[model samples]
Target: MMSVAPSELESPETRLAPDTPWVCLVWNDPINLMSYVTYVFMQYFGYSREKAESLMWDVHTKGRAVVNTGGREQMERDATAMHEYGLWATVQKDD
Candidate 1:
């Protein structure tokens, strides 16, 4: 019988590097108004009304919006911030 080391069990390329970028996606929801979505974007991301509204519109018309992109940790924080603001959000690798 042979045993494989833990590191050997995983593919090297599958590991997430420390500096990889991630995106925070805000998804449209029936309960949240468009204006409220814009407000959340501005309040949490410091985006101007124009930018916030643009992202909100994307979420409305496209079904989702990538509100922000940054390092994995930052994107996670942005997702958490959006959650705190009572909006639907998630983070994923920027691919």
Candidate 2:
């Protein structure tokens, strides 16, 4: 077996690539009402009713919506917030 150098171990800072943006995605599901979805969007995101309704409609018709975009931690928080509101949500790195 070969000996490994201590430098080969990566720090947390080194593990993350710089400038990667993450997005929060809300998925369409049969359980939640469209109006409620819009309400949740407005409540959580502080979006105007019109904007929230638009996003809700997009998820209703298109099957998903990119609700928010930011750093990974922010996206994760948004996803968790959506879950708290009973919406199916996820986070992914923005391409």
Instruction: Please tell me which predicted candidate would have the highest TM-score against the true structure.
Output: 2
User: What is every candidate's alpha-carbon RMSD to the true fold?
Assistant: 8.8, 8.8
Residue 80 C-alpha lDDT in model 2: 95
- Please give me the total number of clashing residue pairs in predicted model 1: 0
lDDT of 2 by residue, 7-51 (tens): 785666777756778999999999999989999999999999999
User: Model 1 — which ten-residue stretch has the worst lDDT?
Assistant: 10-19
Candidate 1, 1-95: lDDT as tens digits: 89999888676666753457789999988899999998888887899999999999999999999999898888888888888888889999987
In order, the Cα lDDT scores of the candidates are 0.89, 0.93
Q: Roughly what TM-score does model 2 have, to 2 decimal places?
A: 0.80
Point out where model 1 deviates above 4 Å: 1-18
Model 2: ten consecutive residues of lowest lDDT: 9-18
